[model samples]
Target: MTLTALFNKSIIVSGISFLLYFSSFLSPGNATSNNARLTSKDRVTTASPAVLVFSKTNGYRHKSIEAGKAAFTKMAADKNFTVEFTEDSTQFNTENLKRFKAVVFLNTTGNVLGDQEQAAFEKFIQAGGGYVGIHSATDCEYNWEWYGKLAGAYFLNHPGPKNVLNGKFYVVDKDHPTTKGMPAEFERSDEFYSFKNINPDINVLIKIDEKSYAGGKNGDNHPMSWYHDYDGGRAFYTAMGHTDESFVEPLFLNHVYAGLQYAIGK
Candidate 1:
């Protein structure tokens, strides 16, 4: 062959060899491409997803809000998720809500969001966002029918702050991710709320045994926690985190984590 032809042949050979080497270097047995050794089913995400915890209240605010914040913060660290805590109603815009996988309403009450803010949040949920409501989250946005439906219930009455009940919490749906491993029934002390306008579509996860506590208006099969899909989004609510101690309880934290995880599409 001519010198030029020979040189072109060498270039082709070198190119083929380099490709072979590169392919071998990135093989499934290798670790360079991150989790390369694991199959698709075995692989897991390491990047943390984000969630927003909004605790604004236009009416009665729970003093345990701080504790709830701390609990979620701790959960993020242990569960491989990121959390942003804010009490600012102005943060309910599209730009602010976009980054979150879920928005957690922690003991929020009354009409927390303004007209524009409410519209923005509605858009978020419509765009497949998620919501996790803690304790008195059901107490808010009485005038906003869309929000009331999203929350699944509205606060009616509780036996007052002074009448904390060590109520028997009946596990209604143990199959749900939120209450998957929880006991059949557990006693917890907190202000049990009787809800109004309870959305008929919600999947009840736990019910409070009304007989275990006084002033339990919704006598038989009264729901205390539930979840539902609403307006193209996922929602979970638990009326259990009423006391500061609730945040520290392992069972309670796990329950909340599972719900939040479910909302985030885990």
Candidate 2:
């Protein structure tokens, strides 16, 4: 064959091959479902990395749970992550927890997890998973010594009348990423919690000025937000999400987001 003839023949053969490959998808036998076709060597799964938000409350449930969920969902979307909100403690298993990089206790109070679930979560943390606790998370699992340390404190009491709001947020560790971008001194209206058994090892990100509020039990250096590398994983806790309105506040929401990022090791 002449050089041009050979080249034309090759093109014809390539066209036939391309047509056949394209037609295969149009056939009924090549139907794609359940991500079967998407799970190939060159393709990654569509599932985004996610956080597991557990809001199960066995004690006084916070009404801001819904607001917390909404804010977390937005924050996850901003980072291209997903949020899985669950009230069922059964999801706290080795298999289920493996899907998430971190777990967020959004105002979860009292004994929410069973013995098995607790063990699974501990294993998850030991395996380098993460935890983010908000508001009443400190009020949870008082009998569980490890969890108390993870949450960094146990809730003692809030100010009198249960409405002594907008205490001065004094940045203690301003250089920490969790406190970065936050002002050195700003007032936020939250049902600020005084703490007991405050973990000495925790890196306090921010504290509340006791003199700025009514009930000041924790005294001068009352930590409101903190983070630490606990066990083999990361943990972040903030005691400021007590009201639904706090979720809408830009500073408070970003503070929580920063803590979330820190906890998830992002």
Candidate 3:
């Protein structure tokens, strides 16, 4: 070959080698990429989705709110997800709500969101956002009929003589991710709530054994935790988390995590 042709061939060969080397460097199995991967461990890991914890309440408020928030903040860090806690009603706007994979109502009570805010929230759910209601969240938005169905029930009453009581929890559906690893039967002491306007279609994950406690209103099938797909999004609600200690409980934390996962479409 002529000298000029040979030089051109060498250039082409050098370019091909360079491309191959670059490709290998980008491979996961490569050593140089390993250090780069370690530096970007967060990005290299699973996508860290975010959830918004909204504890707004116009009426009665639970003292566990702060504890729940703290626990959830820790949970977000440990589980590789982002959590933003807020009671501000303005956060309900579509633009703000879009940033969350799920919205968690932690111990919220009474009518919190206004008509416009409620509309935005409804739209958020319809757009495939997730919702997790803890404790008194069922007590909110009683006038908003759509929220009743979304929450699966409205808070009717609890044992008035004592807000906190002892009860035996029965796991009805062990197949659900939230209840999967939990014991079939367990005992817990907390403010158990009675529910009205409960949608019969909801899939109950856990129930309280009324016979184990006094002033049991719901009788044989008192649901403590349940989940269902509502509109275009997922909904999970639990009657627990009334006490500050409940937030620190390992099982309860796991339950919350699992509920979040389900709501986020994981």
lDDT for each candidate structure: 0.89, 0.87, 0.92
lDDT of 3 by residue, 112-226 (tens): 9999999999999999999999999999998999998998999989887778998899999998899968999999889999888999889999999989888778989999999
Task: Give the per-residue lDDT of model 2 (tens digit) for 1-266.
Answer: 89999999999999999999998887777766424565663243345568899999998988899988888888877877778999999999999999998999999988999999999999999999999999999999999999998889899988777664877888998787777788899997889888999889999889989888788798788899899999999999999889999898888888888887787777
Clash pairs (backbone) in predicted model 3: none
Candidate 3: deviation at residue 159, Å? 0.7
Write down the lDDT that model 2 would get. Answer: 0.87
Order of the predicted models by lDDT, top scorer first: 3, 1, 2
Model 3 lDDT, residue 147, Cα: 92
Best by TM-score: 3
Worst 10 residues of 2 by lDDT: 40-49
| Tens digit per residue, CA lDDT, model 1, 120-217 | 99999999999999989999989999998998989889996566878898999889888878899899899899999999999999999888888888
TM-score of each: 0.83, 0.84, 0.84
| lDDT for residue 72 in candidate 2, whole number 0-100 | 83
Error of 2 at 140 (Å): 0.8
Flag regions of model 1 displaced more than 4 Å.
1-47
Q: For model 2, which pairs clash?
A: 166-189
